[model samples]
Target: MPSFLQVAVLLAVVITAAKGAGALSKRLGQPAVFGELLAGILLGPTLLDVLHWPVFTDPPYLERLTRDLAELGVIFLMFLAGLETDLEEMRKVGAAAFFGAVGGVALPFLAGTALGLAFGFPLYESIFIGTILTATSVSITAQTLLELGRLRSREGTTILGSAVIDDVMGIVILSVVVALHQAGLAGAGDAAGGAAAVAAGSSGSTAAAQGADAGGAGALAVGLIVLRMVAFFAAAIAAGRWLLPPILRRAARWPGTEPQFAMALVAGLLLAVAAEELGGVAAITGSYMAGVMLTLVPDVKRAVEERLAVLAYGFFVPIFFVNIGLETDLLDAVAASGPAFLVLILLAAALGKIVGSGSGVRPFGFTWMEALRVGIGMVSRGEVALIVAGIGLQEGVISQAVFSVMVVMTLFTTLITPILLRWSFGRAPGSPSGAAAFSPAPGPRSGEAD
Candidate 1:
């Protein structure tokens, strides 16, 4: 086992490096996350290999500790994501955001899966690749719009709303695909060597029997996956609605300062545990649900968010982003994938979101330019994609090299979005093609930036 001192020192190095890098990135007018990712690469095997210096006798134990911290970062990061979800804003954006998210999700998923198949990946792995491509992070776009004094514009609002819905959709799809992949694995195990069975089934009747058995197994797996997912969502949502409110309301009244914070954290942890053990979904999904539940309470939302941000960002979130780089060997990943897949994946990742999201908003009364703007706005992929990629790696759904390529792809999308979004909005508002108008849905908070 690695000594606690080694772990502490490693964390110190990581946190300092991440914070400094994040500050520099912010100075360059990019988000702090950009710097944090870059720092991870620099500190990882690609450069420093901080996790494997001569001082630490055992590396895996240290790795385990860091990974555990990183996992906490994911939970809090996702929980905050839930907190940011403005339901009222989504309601106002209505069909525009909904269609935008649907299109954003569908096209990317199809395109990514098709690309993976063309590249000779298995069906389940291909689906996982598609899932990786379906995430949208509008944080860069939102910040850009804020800088351009258009954060409250209809396109901006819709992009934010669509992003929120996009996250939820992405999570749901991830769960289903993961369950499907696991089910496939279980069926394969039960087969006890399919090739041997196939060779033995020489007669037509024997072969037919084998086929029927296989078909039956496949059908059962699908049915079970669907039922589990449905039950989880139903129970989780019901708990969020009925169970959470009463618990939180009581916590709000408990003795001691910010008792609700502890209670809320407990709730998130329990839900996260339940999500994996019972719901068969990621723990972060449950945390996210907990966050949404907290949002409903209204009374404790501020307290929880305020306290959580410090704990999350100051430590865990940075580690999570950095650990991504730490675990990735850029040169090996690139070599494994080759230049062609890298370039193609980048293309698929960007175009899938742009075309899918852009076209999705057009029929909903959005002008072509506005639709184009929305598409461009949704182009960035951030933590959501990274989290999914991490899970894919953990579940053995994707390779380390592919994971590294995806990390590179995500950073590329994030960096390029601000420039693209700014250029998209550069056209004069009075121009013929620039007829995008702020038609907020009927509400008191309409036209507000999410």
Candidate 2:
């Protein structure tokens, strides 16, 4: 464990670096998140290990603490995202968003699977790789659109709605894959046990019973995951419609904003925990739903958002972004996977989303150019990709080389999304010359519609 002094020093260094990098990135006309991510890479083993920093040389408990806090930051960030989503606007683009999300998910998944198989990976690993490609992290895209004053535009609304649906689909796919993998393992174990029993000349009943039990358990696990997901959303909607609003309204009337803010935070945290523990869904999803619930009371929604934004953006959110960078060792990853493989992986990640999601919105009457913008917007994979990759790594479903490639791909996509989004949106209809038309400005804060 790290001493108090070490922990304090780490926080100070991380915060300072994140803030300084963010400021520089903004000054350079890029998103602040880019700078924060880079700052982490510089301070982490990727660069700082060369200097033999104590923090890098001897792993400290502070690193774990920081990781946990960073997770909280993600939860808060997603909560804010949910709060900012305009339901009314989402309703307008519902059909387009649904189709876009489906197209986005299906195409990338198929491409990723085919690529992984072509690279000689096993069927399961290939499927997981494809699963990783299916997520769409739109925080970067949303920020870019907000900056361009297009977040409230038709395309923007569809992008945001589709991104949410994309996340849900990704989570479902992840659960299914994990459950199936577990079942496969159980079947293998049963086969091994049966072979041993036959060699020993023992009755096979015991092994058969064990196999039956294992099979049943695997099936039950999958069923529970699905049930929990349904229950969570159903409960969240019910609470939002009936229970939460009165409590929030009553809390809003209390002296000062503390009571209301405290209520919102507590509710969010509780829901997030429940989602993970009971619902088997990502905690960020729960927090997001909580934010959506809170939005039901419009009068206090802005107040809650304003106060929470300070806590989130001022500290936690930046740490989350930086922590993503710290987890990666890019040089080693490239060495292990080979440059050619890495390039292929990156291309698959980028092009899969573009083609999948872009094709999805075409039927919604989007111009080809507009569909392209939506596709590009969906290309940036952020925390969701990282979380899924981490799970795969922990479960030994993905190799270290694959994990590293995913981290690199996630960062690369995030960095280029804003530029691509800007370029795509800058091309106005009927403009003769395709010169850049949009001037980037600090738009509405992250998560808010323009």
Candidate 3:
């Protein structure tokens, strides 16, 4: 545990940094996340250590403390993400969003996995690498639509709906990959023991036979992991619908309205933790579901969003990005990936999202040009992609080289989104819904940027 003074100083740093960076980003016409990421990089090993900050070198606890606070940022982020989801709207554009999200996740993941596998990555690593490519930060695209005042239009609805699916599907893919990776690691451990038994055996035949058994066991382990994940998700879905509502309703009637937010936060985190404990995918799944449920209720949703935004912008988010910067070994990540690999990753990242999302919505009767614009609109990746990549790197499923490649991919995609939205929509003829224009992408009607 950190000392009281240490915690206080760390909190102070996060608030100052986030606010400063956010203001700068807004001024530069960039998304606040860009500034946050930049702030993190500046405070991290790359810059602070390079400049020889005494605090970084002398106190190990400071770094860890920063990380802990930043993690809270991630949680708050997910809470907000959940709050943004609208199930009724999602239902309206279900087909387009479903296909768009599926295609978007599928292609990039496959491309990434294939690249990793071709480079001699193990199966689990390849799968994880691919999983990193799954999420679309629809927030970026939504922002563009908002600037253009097209957010409430059909295309806007389709994009938002698809983005939600994108998040859910991305989490599912990540979970499946994690399950497989865990199984593989366990199997490898078991195989090591089997190999030792063979080495001590009397004959070569016995060694070969043992190796075969180990392989079979590895396959079985993988199967069991998949089964476990399926069971966990099924239980969660049932519980969310059948059990959570009444509990939330009861909590809503309690003494303080603040408890409603508390209940939702507690429920979201618990659900996430439960999912992870059960070998299911992203912990944020529970958070997202909680958001969906809270929105369904008439009175509680506002309080929940209010509390989440306050906590998010106030402290947690800045700390998270700053810690991300501190932990980043940028040179190592870049050196491992190399220029050629980086280029390939970038191309695949852009093409995968554009092609997948663009094609998916066409059957919904959107004009081909509108579909292309939507695809371009959705192409930029953001926080979700970074989170996914961070998970893969932390799990040791991807080397620093692959992780670096992902960072570059994220940077390029995010940086280009505003420009693309501006250029594409600016040329279109004016429409009442503002779907026809591109320069001023839509902003959220909720007026809650936090």
Return the top candidate by TM-score: 1
TM-score of each: 0.91, 0.86, 0.88
> Cα lDDT of all candidates, in order?
0.83, 0.77, 0.71
**For candidate 3, lDDT tens digit of each residue in 103-216?**
888888898888778877777777777777776887767766766777776877888888888888887777777767777788788778777886777377877787788889
Over 1-450, each residue of candidate 2 has an lDDT whose tens digit, in order, gives 346666666778888888888888778866676677788778767787422355443455556777888888878877886777667756778889988999889988888788888878888888988899898777778777766767767788789889878876887787667656765776677667767876888667876776677678767766777787788889988987798778877887899848988998988999889877777776776888888877777877887887888888887877776776677677888898789878887888888888888899998789999899888989988766876776677567888778778888877887788888989888445533311433433223442121
Candidate 3 TM-score versus the reference: 0.88
Which candidate order results from sorting by lDDT in descending order? 1, 2, 3
Error of 2 at 173 (Å): 3.4
lDDT of 1 by residue, 282-401 (tens): 888899888887777666777787788777888888899899999999899889988888898899888888899999999988898899999998888977889999999999999898
Is 2 or 3 the stronger prediction by TM-score? 3
C-alpha RMSD of each candidate structure in angstroms: 4.9, 4.2, 3.6
TM-score: the better of candidates 1 and 2: 1
Model 2 residue runs over 4 Å out of place are 50-52, 55-58, 120-125, 147-149, 175-201, 254-257, 394-399, 427-450
Ranking by TM-score: 1, 3, 2
